[model samples]
Target: MTTPARQPAEQQPAGPPRPAGRLVLAGAPLGRATDASTGLAQALATAPVIAAEDTRRLHRLAADLGVDVPGRVLSFFEGNEQARVPQLISALQDGQDVLVVTDAGMPSVSDPGYRLVAAAIEAGLVVTALPGPSAVTTAIAVSGLPVDRFCFEGFLPRKPGSRRRLLAELAGERRTMVFFESPHRIAESLADLAQALGPDRPAALCRELTKTYEQVVRGSLAELRDWAAGEVRGEITLVVAGQPAGSAQVEAAELAELVSVREQAGQGRKEAIAEVAATAGVAKRLVFDAVVAAKRGG
Candidate 1:
């Protein structure tokens, strides 16, 4: 981005020096430029410093809004956020309001801005935000799932083993889950989600949210996996149904079968029952009773 020369103090009319300026974490438009909040234009015209993830996009947004950014623009992406927070905090300490904006959505969300926000807070500086379009809430609103209670899991790990492990950890989570995925890995992620959560678990795959070519695919995880087999593109957001209440437990007979396999693998009967209880989400006493009944040929 083109950096403008700093305005000299004497260039402006004399006025009382301002107090410590606030750190504003503003949400940039996710897609259409018009989606920017009303305060955005005012902030652009007045903020003394603007830290943008992509200065080009920031400039484009300013042009679309028909406003001038009288602030000093700095590249504040993930690559340089750590190195740039000190500069931003220094500006805040000098009574210059610093505005933070990402390429899209809110800053500090799966994007850069957390480090700076944290630094500002630790330094006892005022920090605020401008609420606007967010892909996370946007996806949930259209997910067709219970939105009253939900959790955002951010982006799943790239490694297959790590991804599966994370999914397994969430298998019994009762609240709806939201995730962001890359187009290239959506297919594999959906497939893994189906296996770890359940093929019949309801889910929605939201793509290019709030943009032209926006599409939402809602179905069971298994169905989504099949659909993702074809060429898919654009940014992706996934919302998955939570496990049903008391639905994770297995039947005593199935629990007995699992315990039997564990015993055959050289585990003691008591230890096998305990292991099955934890793994199958069943009570240990239930497996013990099933095993005893099987021994009596009942």
Candidate 2:
């Protein structure tokens, strides 16, 4: 009989090995403090270094979780993240388990942990995460739109022209889109979105997710734009459905009809172009070009 083949030690199944000074990115609660995971609490308690977007909020979370954060909590925010990453990397190199926590949601998802995480990974240090709740995912869940695939656009440009231009560029996006907008700008943004995307486009406006006063308004972009115009308040997350099939077939004739409809409804020429473009699932530039062409009798 042939002798049984001997397996190498590297091929043998073994118990989990200790991490080489792993970097743990912990997700903090979006609202209530009770949402933190047990693993996150323990990591916070035992980590040798803590990097937080907001130190005060980190302290608050530690207090709420009843976890004694023995490690020094250092500020790691947008302005300082780049400069602070090297220091965090050094700590990790020194065999210190560094835990990164953000003000809310997961660190690095529209939060401040990306730089340090990227740096640690580049340094060949083991990096892991203690997953927690995220407003982006939560809002998408309640949005009632297609969630199979989606793109998270943290926020639209503040300027109307820039925002419209950006929306125009997204006209051909095939996946559902998510956006974070301040309450003050939500109305204008929705209005611009409806004009750029089309009034009939399906969408949802999610507000104050996971909070006591959470609200989700689902409807066509036009209707939501109108709704937003009327005393809307709270943190906002907007979900817009993607372009529909054969949407590109909407020609100048159909665009003219759209312009006529909205023009009669008190929409300006520019706004009409935006609305038509959005409804037709085409670019605002296309619709605007058509409108200009129609005016020039092209």
Candidate 3:
């Protein structure tokens, strides 16, 4: 997705935005409360209105951090997120800073807060974040899989048919994937992923990350599925390796020919190589190497 070129400041309408209260998105730790950032602590201690996914968790976290939440605590979870966004926005519009926190990790990431954030933005309010530990990045770093280029799919579909359809669509994805899964559904999801992505596809199961019982299990999709069968538990983050490079599906000769054809049509080698890679859904390096090998062979 190419971002459109920004208009010149002079040419911009600017929406004539107003300055009221800002929305602070605070990221909570996946496990240990200590992982919370200082900014997060300060935000929790001082925000005038807090929209928490779970008020109980917020209180527990504050207790652990030895801070007091002087602000009015409001429940802002999935079930009530829609109903509560308006109220939170109202508070912000009244020049009262509103802090949004989820039970774990960043808000709006498979959690509550997106609606409120979007509302705040549409209302021309300032929005900022207190970043902290995220299971998606942590699991990818330790997954032993390629992480330079990856995508987070969040939680996999719960329904078998939906899950299967999604898996089928992702079968050829070349970017590493990260997903959140429940302990009960881990076994079934893994099995389905393996069946769709292939049994030998590399993957990792990260359970209770950063906690005392933290475990990182790296193996093939089939192996992870088997391990998940034997009493798996905890907040899970699964990292699966992407399908092998698309070059594997195309002969070097064919890849070289594709690039050459594009080059013949008034395209520079770099542009031709990029075009071939994009069309073939492969990496540029692979296509370049194939072109080089074909030159040597000739």
Candidate 4:
């Protein structure tokens, strides 16, 4: 038989090599595995490499969802996330799809995927996300607070002083605020929030979200602080109502009224005047003058 002419390498129709690898940040269930989306399950099942914030928790999640993660699992947490960036990037460069997941919620929102994602972007790799349950959004949705415009504050500083300073800075933030807190410190945090943001500020404490013991408590910051004082458990998310528009334009009369209210609530005259001045974004002298004028008028 006549030998067929071999196709030149240049003329070979091998098709385009599959486009370079992808990095997918998948959101895990906040509490219930049943809340996981189909895309998340498929990613867990098929990705060649899986980087998890908690490997053991990832496995437990897989078991809960009855999905098998057949890929090589790597621990990608806060401690080692930076070290693992190069390895994960190498995998993506080698055209292997990799999935990055946290123990709960989407990766990189107060999670470990930020370093990897930023590294991938700098390295010119394809990076995408598989949206799933988020405690931030879930808490806001159930918070009954104004969500038309909001900001996620994530976790506040753990130390009381730092936390208070941060809260004071945000006291005048007009956008609705969302925060995450550990169960142990929720009460103290709430109390500090009440003190810094004002006791009558509308807020909600969403605890153990999307779980059997889920609770959403909505009230003034003071009430929530008192409620949080007794045996609060599970993951907690706090949503605080934003300062009203033009709240900074408080009239002297309004400031005086606030001082009176605080005084009625057992705050000393000086303490109440100072509190009103701070909250109303006015000067202490102005508040003191207002209180004095009101006292003379009464």
Query: Which candidate wins on TM-score?
Result: 1
lDDT of 2 by residue, 1-298 (tens): 8998987668667867545688888878888888888888898888889998989988988999898889988999999999998888888887788888888888888778887888888889998989998888998888888899999989899999889878877876768999989999999999888877778999999988877898899999999988887787777889999887577445555777788789889989898887777656567777776666676774
Question: Where in model 2 is the C-alpha error above 4 Å?
Answer: 1-20, 249-298
Spell out the clash pairs found in candidate 2. Answer: 195-274, 195-275, 196-278, 197-278, 198-278, 198-279
Q: Write the per-residue lDDT of candidate 1 for residues 60-140, one digit (tens) a residue.
A: 999999999878999998888899988899999999999998988999999998999899999999999998889999999
- The lowest-lDDT stretch of 10 consecutive residues in candidate 4 is 244-253
Q: Encode model 3's per-residue lDDT on 1-298: one tens digit a residue.
A: 9999988778655675445898998989988988989999888899999998889999999999999999999999999999998888888888899998999889998999899889999999999999888899999999999989999999999999788768866766789999999999999999989887779999999999999999999999999999888898789999999888753455557879998998888899999988876565455777788899889888
- Model 1 spans with C-alpha error above 4 angstroms: 1-18, 251-298
* lDDT (tens digit, per residue) of candidate 4 on 227-290: 8878978888889999786663355578788988888899999988778766764457767877
Model 4 spans with C-alpha error above 4 angstroms: 1-19, 251-298
lDDT value, residue 47 of candidate 4: 91
**TM per prediction:** 0.82, 0.76, 0.78, 0.79
Summed over model 1, clashes come to 0
Candidate 4 is scored at a TM of 0.79
**Residue 149 lDDT in candidate 1:** 97
